[model samples]
Target chain A: MVTEEEIESVSKLVRIKVADHREHIEKVRDMINFFEMLDSAGVEDDELVMDDVPVSRLREDAHESFGGLSGYVREYRDGYVRVPKMD
Target chain B: MNHSSIIRASALEYVRGVTSGEFTAEEFLSETLSRIEEAEARYNAYLHVEDGQKLLARAREIDRGIKSGQKVGLLAGMPVSIKDNICMRGSRTTCGSRMLEGFVAPYDATAVSRLNAEGGIIVAKANMDEFAMGLTTEFSAYGPSRNPWNTGYVPGGSSGGSAVAAAAFECVASLGSDTGGSVRNPASFCSVVGYKPTYGLVSRHGLVSYANSIEQIGPIARTVSDAALVLGVIAGRDEHDDTTADATPATDYLEGIEGGVEGMRVGIVDEMTEGADPEVARAAERAAGNLEAAGASCERVSLDMVGYSVPSYYTITAAEAASNLARYDNLRYGYDLPLDGYEFNSYVAEARGRFGPEVTRRMILGGYVSSAGHAGRYYLKALKVRAKLTREVADAFASSYDILMAPTVPILPFRIGEKTDDPVSLFMVDLNTVTANLTRRPAVSVPYAVSAGGLPIGIQMMADSMQDRTLLRAARALEMRRPPLPEVPD
Candidate 1:
């Protein structure tokens, strides 16, 4: 049920630059069609299960500095992670 | 100890051998390391094995600990393999993806920390599907892990390598993460025991996220007692992962494992075995009959919601993967790529292309299903199905069933490359295993029978949440009654 346009849009949305998303449209459609069986799942009145934790159970909102974390950055200088140009 | 005893011994036997001076830990590990090299040549089960010298040094220390009569630890000197996604401090945890190939974990996962604390030797990091996105190990960026039972056939995955290593005796036992049958699927194919604990029973702090809500770190071992041994070490509360259930630390899983299934109510899930391969369906029926003979009452039970479980599982996992994987923008840790002239959008888009085809498709589907325009029909409805499914399983347990049983997978292992192109066919492999994940229950796969072609089949048993001990005892009971299983062919 998915079109090539929708496939391209989703690829872009996920930050995956599939230059030819048309090539994948058929397989993606097949997967979606498989997933569409949920439409007939007979769960119309069921509420989604949420793992709700009480505020008391939540850990104290204290932030502890994790040493050596910056070292994991691929490109790091002067306590900052380097990235490609924003624009 | 002879080479056969050292290589093929169960985890407990290895511990007993080492502690009772039947052999030294150094001797056991040396033999295991040598066998690992041979097994990897034949099956490609390991992603990485630690340097022999380093591994031996640890084993020697354990030997000294035992000699000096110091309090060594519970595991003594048994070797265990970890699925690659579970972080071990300073180990290269690739997660079977090119994206993190060079990423050395900075700190120990709670489970790994506990394993080390208990004197377990991490012999190797087992291979898995990339980001744990596939049912089979074929999606690994590196080559797939072949089944030890039949080299031409696949070891079911994403924990294929864990099961293969355990089944082939590369390690005495191994740890695998079960998101949707990753552990049990391969264990079934490899003829080993795989146990997925109730959600939150095992800490998820060290595991790379696929679907955070449903996945758990579990053990794959040749025997149910060995799996219980490892599970006892890793299953407990941790300050690191708040999602951990309120349970005693290092709870004894084997204390009552021989309690037997006498007078227990067993439900054989009908939907899980309908249309299964005749051999597999017959195996489930035989398993039920065996349990009946062992004094557990068995009957056919219908689970209507299981029909919708696979699609719902895929939908929810896809969405979560998209969100979880958004962290890999290449601004941080990843493989080397030049960053000259390109802007942020272009840089990240190109960087993210390193993902495997299955991961890419899930990301796309994840984005589409979670999008505002389609959420009502796809993402939210999938959640409803999950809730409904959970309720159905819980009701079955509450009313009449002390445990539920089914064939771990609906079919026997096929040769690799046979079902790679068929996504739906692959999804069905998780048919019986996903209900445990979705409903937050504990499930175990016990190797039951081998097909005429020599493919291994496993019987799956599930129990209500927090009833892990009951599940283990039931699995043990079945393990005791099953016909003898043949050795994995060399």
Candidate 2:
């Protein structure tokens, strides 16, 4: 079983706060234990190449920015984005 | 057409009636909205139904266009539901998550745009699992969508609401995203036709991403023809999503779908059916027998890699979901939160607490597996297994079969809360469906049988990637031969 401290560490790494820390530790432990089945899958870590698209299939390198997008920023004030007011 | 028949009509039927002056689009909209008012209360199928007045006004516009012989698109004001994860310019795309509960979308998804251009009326936003994470709608932050067949039982999810909307006649069709069988699972439970198109067949530009690599926007409808009709509208190349196929396969998927599956080959995947309930297992066999009667050969083809498909699929999707969902840091596109007396990281962490338990759990697993210490043991190994599974499926497709058949789910729909506590058991329900997602194949669930207790059973048919047309034909053939289905009870 994973320690609660380990769960806290993993949560910090992902920047999530699992409310019932102990409960989630149990759930996540079961998930990791489920993942352990991959060990016997008889697969080696081969070079990763899958669903590959050739470079010729790539779109043109041109990039255009969305113009006049401030209207979309729900909290936009003038030209600046509104942040939560600091204490 | 009267109100009941208007509500019950299929997508194509609705279009034909509206176009040929049998029923106006406004009449159809009013009847459909009335049906939703009655049914949505029992099923909880819609997270947000569009404003009835506003929708009726749009329907009136379409009706006028039809009256004047304006260039009406194919759909002719067909009422359709969109799963909440797919953005429409003005609707709240909540994704069944409280974190995004108030986030109205500013742009339309490519699929939504296509459906609208073809005159499909967006009637409601269907419910789903939070972040499209769970196998049952029990994980929905709002509430579970019940099966139309039995309100006490679950509608299989995370496209549960989409299936229910279609099955209960609340909408003509629905668009749902399928990652690891979200669309087909619910369709199986609700006695609807759910299709997951080949990767890149439908553009995913505005879909709220849970697992980008494997997910595709698909249609859930009352029949195979309705699914194919919606697929024809929303499929094909899109400049916004480069991943969409450049040489579009066929925009008219409904064109030759009546082509019978005579002299076709189907592989009944042994891994998918070996553990099914006896009745479910028998249904797969019965479907095979039907195909055989249609002059198609049916045989068991075992792909051992499928045994490992679930773990690989979950692993890859978790990693992608963690990355895809990291943007909801409470700053850009999230519900409001107070930021007083806290540092940046701490404030953001506080806000992210809004994520439901399932999404949080996956993100944690995602972080651990992709972290440096565990990457070799979990993430990379899972990818290798995914590669092996893909190759194995590819070989089977190339060397042996035209379609693969299986029971869409391993068991009939359970009670809503029956399997929520057992995550692994819930994951196992996806066993028969994930091979299609992992291999990026086109798959469909055709409602095949009804259990003795009145639950639905769907027969899943899959084909090689981009063989959606062939897959649809096989599904239609099965639908034609199956026993007459019971109507969803009032």
Candidate 3:
């Protein structure tokens, strides 16, 4: 079972606040226990199949004009997205 | 004309009517809009219906083109609803989350653009589970979409509204995204035809990411041919999505679809049927029997790795989802909380807090599985298991069968809140449908039988990866054999 502290640590790592960490801890524990079923599949010798497209065949990087740039960014000034201060 | 009849017409019928000038596209759009308004109050299928005048204006152009001897595109003003996760330029594409509540998309998803280019009219944005995480529409921030068959029950989700819109005749067809049975589950629950193409067959560009590796935009319609027609339109290589294969586009999915399934080998997945509701299992068996009567050979096929599909599916999806959804950090496109005198982390936390419970749970679990220590033990192991399962399914198809069959869902549609409390129970409902997503194969759900309680049960048919047309042909054969289903009454 996952402890509340572990849930808190995960929440911080994921950058999402858990409203009731205690309630979610038990639910998360139950789900992890369900995931434990994967241990029985015995895949130690299996070779991973890489289905992704090869990088060599990729299209050349080219700029395409999009008219909706203003709609996509929540806050933009002088064609740049504005972000909150970090320090 | 009865507005319901016009809405209930097959997508092909609508296309044919508009292209041949048999009925003005404007008249058809008005009837469809009126039916949507009538059904919206009872079924809650649409999150946002397009303005009737805009849709009618587009339809009027198609009619004028037809009269002017100019060839209109294939779909030619056929009305369709898009699941809200798929971006349509200038429309709010909320994925049923408060995080993107007021966010408007600047560009259309590839499928949306294709549908528009083919003259398919976008009538509404359908509701879904927030971030496509839940099995029932109950997780949607817009509230649950009620099953048209019984307003008290849930329309299965996260494509619940898409299925409901098609089933209730609010649209001639609808588009949905399937990651682990989202399309097929709702299609079964609502008695519509849903098709989940092979993972890369349909481009994923402009779809709000859930699990990048597993999800694909699919089609929902009232009939098998209509689903195939829509699939033909939305599928093929997209320059934007590199994951798409260099395969030939299916230009004639409706052609020769009525050809009977003679000499085709059908496998009834033993593992998928073991613990399914008796009615669901029996319906699958009945479907098999129907296929056999159509001269297809049927047999039991055992896939030992099938049992691991659900766990592997959830693990991979959660990990992918955690990575895919991390971009909604309030800085760019989604709902933002003011950071007045607050730390950057706190602002992000507040913004992400807008996610519903199910999305939060999945995201948290995804983080847990992919974290440093657990990555090797859980995430890596899950990938290995997924690899093994994919190989096993490929081997099964190569040696044993041309197609596999199973119940689309394990049970009938439950009341809205019946399974919401137990998250595992909801995950279990996806047992039969997740394998297709995991294996990256094509699957379609067609309504096979209705329960004594009058709820519809659908049987899922799967074909090897990229064999989507074959699956549709089999579904069409079965659709031809079954008695036509009655329309859900308003």
CAPRI category for model 2: medium
Q: What is the C-alpha RMSD of each candidate to the true structure, in Å?
A: 1.6, 2.2, 1.7
Native-to-model Cα distance after best TM-score fit, residue B296 in candidate 2, in Å: 0.6
Reference-based lDDT, residue B104, model 1: 86
Highest DockQ scorer:
1
Rank candidates, TM-score, best first: 1, 3, 2
1 versus 2: better TM-score goes to: 1
Count steric clashes of candidate 2.
0
TM-score of chain A of each: 0.76, 0.63, 0.72
Query: For model 3, what is the error of residue B301's alpha carbon versus the real structure, in angstroms, after optimal superposition?
Result: 1.1
Q: For model 2, how does the per-residue alpha-carbon lDDT over B245-320 read when each residue is reduced to its tens digit?
A: 8777868888778888899999999999998999999999999999999889999999999999898888889889
Misplaced by over 4 Å in model 3 are A68-70, A77-80, B333-336
* True contacts recovered per prediction: 0.79, 0.58, 0.62
The DockQ-derived docking category for candidate 1 is: medium
What is the Å distance of residue B144 in model 1 from its true position? 0.4
Per-residue lDDT of candidate 3, residues B195-291 (tens digit): 9999889999999999988899999999999999998899889888888878755666887788779999999999999898888888888888899
Q: What residue runs in model 2 are displaced by over 4 Å at the alpha carbon? A: A1-4, A51-78, A82-87, B1-3
